[model samples]
Target: MTQQLDFSVGMGKETTYGSPSAVTRFFESEAKAKYDVKTIKGSGLRPTKGVARTSRQSISGFEGSTDIELDAPTRGLGFLLNAVMGAVTNTLVSTGLYQQVHTLSTTDPVASYAIQEALPPIGGGASNVHTFRGCVFDSLEISAKEGAYLSVKLSATILKMLTTGATAASYPSDDTLFSFVHGSIQVGGSLTEPGATTLAVGDAIPAVNISDFSLKVARNLDKKGWNLGGAGLRSRPPVLGKPEITGKITAEYTDNVLRDAYLAQTPLVLILTFTSGSNVLQIAMPAIKLKGEVPTSNGGDVITQSIDFEAFDNGTASQPIFIVYRTADTTP
Candidate 1:
């Protein structure tokens, strides 16, 4: 007999941040469900150590945290990105027309969601399904190559964990590939773009050879734990700390334009888009400034510049980091 393999994974958009769901509705709409899942790795129950006078080893306390790794996706990745950045979408209904826009504004508080995965049994028992509750997006890194599909690596923090017999069995629909061929990188002095919302598909930096680019967002999360003479498991919500956003870009150095931008502290806008006929998906970061080390040299086959930048508030909601997804279906 062959062994059972673990493959199915599902997630839900939480109505309330850090609130666990009933597990009854584990999947989202088939059309909007995130399907380009590359990998799911998690940390089981970890214990904090305490020293005592009698024992040689330290004492074990309540479970610390369950950190999970969700590999990045090209298609349908914005849904998960919204959860971590506390980004939200707004639907404007006009005369027989509905427009959906996703935004990650400075004033917006980050949101949370629930994630679960099915694993194979270890010793010929029933399949085990684990659910992570109160899960918050901690950090994310997106890597994009010239011709390859954009890869995303995501990290999330959870408050609690639950295991049960595997029953939910289904996968979401396939996704259209998103790659650097359908992306754009622009550097300017200000966050203001003349026609940002209506940017055409061919609007990108000209004569610049871009090899790769990356973006990282971090929400400094802290957990509270105090001794109160307790017997049962004590759980508290993970507190959000000062958040951070940073990114890097590797490109062929053609001119002194990037160096000039760094010296004058200029802003940059990154727009990655995927389109097939009338369907479109995009991730836009309208306000970002270079704060890291300036590119000197990559010492590679070609003269390349590897520069890092930090995301900043542009003092306007329209200029903030956002994701715009257009499909026939409304829900995501």
Candidate 2:
């Protein structure tokens, strides 16, 4: 029997934490589910043997990751956004058009998901399905460059992995991808909550030319929250620590706006918008401080500035980071 590389990934929100949910949406992705096992060995000193004897190994827990092409899917990406951001307010903006405003939740008990990975069958053999339950995002990264599509990398901590009773993968047909051609950046914008209203056009930076950008958000979950009597699995959901939002932007060194802000320790707002037909995704950093160096010339090429930034709570906004996604999906 010859093995093939055919695989599929699907996910759905769990009604109860750690309970398996039916896969409702699929992703075009390179995804995997990993198991973490603990090995135990005898520590007693042997009289004649030189090597220690091995005892046993057992499953501890599970984790997984998915690298996805960021698409303007009407419904699918909302699950991921909610998993990371903790809360979302979805509303219908126009006829058949919906807007989802994702924000950080101050309350405990965020959303959890069940992810299924369907492995290819060996010739006529039965395909294996691995389902990861109580899946929560440990970290998420969104990045894009000129002439490239937006990409997302998600790291998740899973409570358990079940290999049985999972449905086959099926994907939606209405998803559209977001590329760099559909992207725009605005720096030093007015800090405004992206609710029903969009950002004003006059808030854009004067003449900055951005080539590439990347943003990363980490949940910093405490993975050792396991109890002694409940087996090696987590007794409760992993405790979330302070979130860290950081990113980098590469742009043509046309002016000193970014450098001057960094040198003077000034705070600024960063907004990135992407449009795919009628769908829109807008990411806003209400307060950010630049930490990158000034642009330096190298060889005869166009000078560029790669600026590092950190997002912070502006004390008035809903959260340190906000995302407004407009699509046709009515439900989150």
Candidate 3:
């Protein structure tokens, strides 16, 4: 799933000079879900539902894991003007690059000096090879608009609601074609300005004036045998009214470099929510740490990171029955 993150970064250069101002975007609202859902909208009367039963069984805990891969897309590089052979570094470099060249800024260059410099410059423009699976995210790129930096904060949230179709007796496979909604941005463009702007359906930011957005991860969670009552202080509050089976995972940073680092190996939180009668409740996955981290072979260029997880339980059950993601509004 995708969420809004304010991505802005400057190494010794931008820091010494001045970093771009980061705009804060909160999760506004998502487009009407294609499913048959009942959400609260407008001011007037909010939707009121049933209360949670303290005596019922619930999931107590769980963890998040990850898997990742990377490739230099054709749009980003490969060939150059026939006369000039592009320089290439097989691995990543610690010092970030700008305009396809070594970024000269550094803290103590002598200490973390780049292992290798520039990799062969890849041509820019359309047909850039794209990589995505599970939940697809957007890439960062320079924008034509003014006052905009080139990066996304890179926050991601996923929700897994126990759908009616997925019962205690069912198990899903990689081939299952369930409906999914994802929201995200990579290393390009800043958050949109705040104002009374018109919003599109599924757009995280509302009429503007907020930083960050969220998407539905999974709906219809299930934990047939878990004892959710043990969650004492770790419990998430119930929402009175809203849309979708809301859940989320979020991490924030104005520094694109750091954000990239996190992308390589940062723990992301995922929340799962459910509606029973009139009450809406959520389940939490205690840990979202990545499975591992890998440095580029030569240069310090940050590439891919991954994580792993086994669906958790409230201790009442033995197997993981629920999933989680992000909500449209992240303010609370």
Residue 59 in model 1: lDDT: 31
Worst 10 residues of 3 by lDDT: 109-118
- Cα misplacement distance, residue 144 of candidate 3 (Å): 24
Task: Judging by lDDT against the true structure, name the best candidate.
Answer: 2
Error of 1 at 90 (Å): 4.1
Candidate 1 stretches with Cα past 4 Å from truth are 1-4, 13-76, 90-100, 105-110, 122-126, 165-167, 189-207, 225-234, 292-300, 316-319
List model 2 lDDT by residue over 22-130, tens digit each.
Answer: 7887777755667666545555675786675544333554444444444445447776777787878888888978888887766667567888887877674556788
- Name the TM-score of candidate 2: 0.91
Q: What is the alpha-carbon lDDT for the whole of candidate 3?
A: 0.20
Q: Which parts of model 2 are misplaced by more than 4 Å?
A: 1-5, 46-75, 197-202, 206-208
Q: For candidate 3, lDDT tens digit of each residue in 165-278?
A: 111111112111111111222221222211112111122221111123222222212212223552322122111111122222222222343245345654333332222222
Per-model C-alpha RMSD: 8.0, 2.5, 26.8
Question: What's each prediction's clash count?
Answer: 1, 0, 66
For model 1, how does the per-residue alpha-carbon lDDT over 229-289 read when each residue is reduced to its tens digit?
5222234445567677788877677877777778888776666555544445555676677
Report lDDT per candidate: 0.54, 0.76, 0.20
